[model samples]
Target: MQLPIDFQPGWAPADIEDASAHRFLFLQGALVVLRDGDGARLPDAAYRDLPIGVLHSVGVLDGRACHMAELSDAELPEGLEAVPLRQLFNRLPEALLAVAGRAQQLLDFARSHRFCGACGHANELFDEGRARRCPACGQVAYPRLAPAMMALIKRDGPNGRELLLAHGARFPGVIYSALAGFVEPSESVEDCLHREVFEEVGLRVKNLRYFGSQCWPFPHSLMIAFVADWASGEIVADPAEILDAAWFHIDALPPLPHQITIARRLINATIAEVAPDHPALSVYGAG
Candidate 1:
């Protein structure tokens, strides 16, 4: 699969000509608003001439069309369909991806919180351009991060070739992924993992091992990944969180999301551990 240009971590260097001083326009949801003459759609161009800063990235938006179609090697010009930048993080490297992801979360949160909840008055951007404060009640607001965890359960069967997998109702076709859930207030990541497993599927997971983490901003989710071994119990999916659960062999697996997602990467990593030529080589499928 072709990687997105904006996916590079630290892609936009810090050094720029008076970026903070200028009134940067938000290029939201990959709208790709085109310029009048040249027909270029960039969010915040330099002097409204040369394209420089982008309001959002491709991944954040619905890139299903682009994903299915072959992406051309060219500058992201104007007149593109609208998609959110959140989808681009998995396409980008870690640090730079975080830059766009966090920035988007902050920008989106600030804009959404502009209308005061208490007084029903519009809020204003803070001095640092990082937060929003209500003019009436003087309420200070910051972007919220929802802490969530995903657990990959494994078990040593008599044949030692089976792995547990899950297919959420929301998941398309036969796509499967690890069990995931949001963290409760004051609950530790470890605690959330165990709870999520039981709630989503009627199973007990032991030997929980942290795999990695990624910023899943499909509306602000910091997904923490872990690997756990199945102790016992049958497959039972939560009516709310999951649709179906099952066990599959390592070599043969169902479809999975393609990207830097901890679920797909860890699955592939484990598959590689047993068999090098894993049929499902990529995290976001073969797209």
Candidate 2:
């Protein structure tokens, strides 16, 4: 996938104490950001006038300090508007979008872990690492990430190769995408994929190949993606979680998730593998 932003894994502050015009991503909540031109813009001097505290430095992007803040009951500055992170996908470059997601996740980690769960004492931010330390109990809290699995199942049908897709209970009407679920405490990623496939659609899948991964920071989730082949069982949508389930031909599909998602990546990759010449692959800029 072509990523737009150049992001590094670890945090490296350009200047830890610099108080210049630092770039800011003011998140209205966890999922939305203060929209700027084509991406999130830094809060202007007027915004800096607000009692915004010490900017929690997340990382250096292209040799600049990128920070994020959460605002509550504060009026936004003129010419700036709050936009949902999902919507930002269409407006911002992929790399910037990914960076925004990273910033938001770290900001959330800072906000949610202000107090230690194990000990009632407040937590302190470690200067060198992205961790919150508790003074009383010596418990260290790191950024929380929930691991989820996504499976794009394929099977040969009467006519040709087909891909399995499902509509989640959260989706409206006929919209469908890859089958996914969160990993439980004791289960492995493979185990979770199998169990989720069986439970959601009453189907078994095999040849679980790791396709790719994406950071879905809808409240901090690491989406582990896989492509699998249908092994057994019939289509039986679980009423509680799945609205419907079916195997679709490569040429025909419902309105899918956005292009930037790992679900779309798995779908497009599978279609390219099974039917490279299929016209639907054109949507993903494939032959």
Candidate 3:
């Protein structure tokens, strides 16, 4: 459960944060603590007093809100569960956690949806409640996920093996990600993947292997990732989205993201570079 570079593992003890759309355990009051990236300890006292909400799940422990598993593997350290947040998503039987996670996502959406686009009336949660509504403009607002793409480009390795990968143009140094982009209007997921690959790397692909999916809440995103083979063309990094593109030996890969994301898990596993798993759910608050 190693978290990506920009991940922060934060949980609102059931008592500390209120779980909307129905109460969730993550919101219950408990002494939760975290040892962030800087190796600093974040005590429960630091956040216990904030207004009951889900924003605590955001990246505050460090530069980014990483998954809790990024912190440790041991469960119940000194009476606190030292675990990763993924376990919540992967382990929990229901979308209760996902609901909370989504609530955290929508919690954010609601903040931004407060303003009215047409009549300029403040929005309120109503419609039995459909979610949110504007008092003046009669505009109903709801949580949304921006459709995005995730693809793996294929090429022939020096040894005759296939090399596939996706790269984002805005990555750090020497870092390329899986091919992904926002699914445009009137286009299928596969269509967007094809167009994005061509537009970004100038390569067409086939046999799009559907791996899995994850609901990314960075301002709301639904990440649909796939594993595709080389259809035709050469490597060309689309300046609009792809910073640079290349093929790896499939065995020797570059820096990859954490298992919390489908984008990372898909490509890494495709190349058999599966990242290690860490513990889920960590408790750091005091007695």
TM-score of each: 0.68, 0.87, 0.62
> Against the unseen true structure, what C-alpha lDDT does each candidate score?
0.59, 0.75, 0.53
The best candidate by lDDT is 2
lDDT of 3 by residue, 1-287 (tens): 22233333344322333222122213222213344543223234333333333322333223422221121222333423323334343343233334435544644565567777677777776644335787776777766778887887655555744555545656645655677789999999999999988888888788988877778755478888888889888787767776556776644665565445666667555654231221111111110
**How many pairs in model 3 have backbone atoms within 3 A of each other, for residues 3 or more apart or on separate chains, i.e. clashes?**
42
Better of 2 and 3 by TM-score: 2
lDDT of 3: 0.53
For every candidate in turn, the CA RMSD to the true structure comes to: 8.6, 3.0, 11.1
123-210: candidate 2 lDDT, tens digit per residue: 9877576788998999998998899999999988788878898889987456789999999999999999999999999998889999
Model 1 ranges off by over 4 Å:
1-28, 31-79, 84-100, 276-287
Candidate 1 lDDT (Cα, whole model)?
Answer: 0.59
* Cα shift from native, residue 157, model 3 (Å): 5.8
Best by TM-score, which number?
2
